[model samples]
Target: MSPFVIAITLSAAVLHAVWNAIVKTAVDRTTTLGLVAFGHVLPATVMVLLLPLPNAESFFYILLSTVVHFGYFFMLGKAYQHGDLSVVYPIARGIVPALVSLWALILLGEVLPAQAWIGIAVIALGIQLSSWKVLRSGVGKAALGFAVGTGFCISIYSVVDGIGVRLSGNTLSYWAWGAFLHIFIAGFIGLRKRATLAALPLRVWALGIAGGLVSMTAYGLVLYAKNFAPLGAVSALRETSVIFAALIGLVFLREGNWKRRLGAAVLMAMGVALIGTSA
Candidate 1:
């Protein structure tokens, strides 16, 4: 990856974690997510009015992405329903890059270098270790297990979006439309739950909505960054959210053991080093 792309992805990592931290803080997760949906839609709705329509090809990818993104939001909400943010967030985001790499190679012939593979493995191992807990757990194991499955589906969507953006060849327009479509789908889900309006303090609304903007900024940067690097590399770097989310959970959420968090950091760092060297 080019320095510019690497920098962009790294910056997105920080931003993604920050907004997720905000979501994690919500007293009512569904309400906060509804506001987040509103935040993304309002901007994209404006963009849709100003921008030209996406070509037929872009539309197909965008449509597919919308489905995946909705699934991502659903799984994410369900993941929070099961366990600590520290445990749920990392496994969901952390394990994905490697899985994405595997899928890319099998389907699209996108291969990572051997070193990057090793790096990804190290990173995944570290994340799994950090998230593990003793048998006596407060949360439902079945729910957490399903949550993991949900997160895995999210990885599928990330891969889908990366490939879709590449095939569409107009990342800016694609993202603009994708944002609007994703919001609509999430809104449908939120309405079904009867949690479509803000029922929170003004501060929470402000933060959650602003978080939607931050999310766009982060994902938008990655869409542009994908132009320079292999999708696998770009995808893996984004998954660095695993480390960032872990730190946020520990410090802000007070979610887990210090030793495991340190281990997670070391693993993520080592993986980054390997991927960087491979690049």
Candidate 2:
């Protein structure tokens, strides 16, 4: 990958971690997520209004992604309610790349290096280790499981959107429509829970909006990176969010389950090193 694309991937990693931290720390994960979803629409809707719709062929795929992303947000909200960032974030974020690598091999004709496969496993195993305490702690384990499953759904949409946007040959247009639809769908669900959304404090709104914009920017940069790099590499690089998320948890939330956390960090570092070498 070029320095430029690598830069985008790393930048997206930061934004992704930051936004997730906001969600994890929310008073009500579901309501905060709803606001985030609702917030995302303003930008997405504006883009949809300004840009041409994706061609008919890719439109269905975009719709599919939108549906899956809803599940992602819902589950993520539930997960945050139950678990601390240290545990839930690793489970939700780390597991995706390995799945995505397998998906890329089957769907996109991308072959990852042997070393990267080991890296992927190390990353996953590290996360698995990190989660042991949470599993024993009895806080939102079910919610964490749901969030992890939802993250798998998120992985599917990301790969689909990545491929669909590329096939459309207009990256921004597809992203705008797909992203806008995602936000619109989530916002509608939240509006259905109007009381919860209305009660969100200004502080939450401020943080949520900031997080949303960061997330949107990250998505744009990652999609742009996908244009040039293998999906697997991009996927692995994006998982760097796990490292950042761990730090966020330790510093802000004080989720200092250190034995498990140190192991998780080691696994993430191994993954990053392996990926860097392969590049």
Best by lDDT: 2
Q: What's the C-alpha lDDT at position 31 in model 2?
A: 69
TM per prediction:
0.90, 0.92
**What digit string (tens of lDDT, one per residue) describes model 2 on residues 1-279?**
888888889889889989899888877767667666666667887888888776777887788888888878877777777777777777777777777878888998888888988888788777768776656776566866875886698689778877877776677788787777756666666777788768777898777777777777888888888888877778778878878888888888888676678568668767855764575
Model 2, residue 207: C-alpha shift (Å): 2.3
**Candidate 2 — worst ten consecutive residues by lDDT sum?**
270-279
Clashes of each: 0, 0
TM-score of 2: 0.92
As a whole number from 0 to 100, the lDDT of residue 74 in candidate 2 is: 72
Q: Give the CA lDDT, 0 to 100, for residue 247 in model 1.
A: 83
Candidate 2 collision pairs: none
Judge candidate 2 at residue 41 and give its lDDT: 69
Model 2 misplaced stretches (Cα beyond 4 Å): 134-140, 276-279
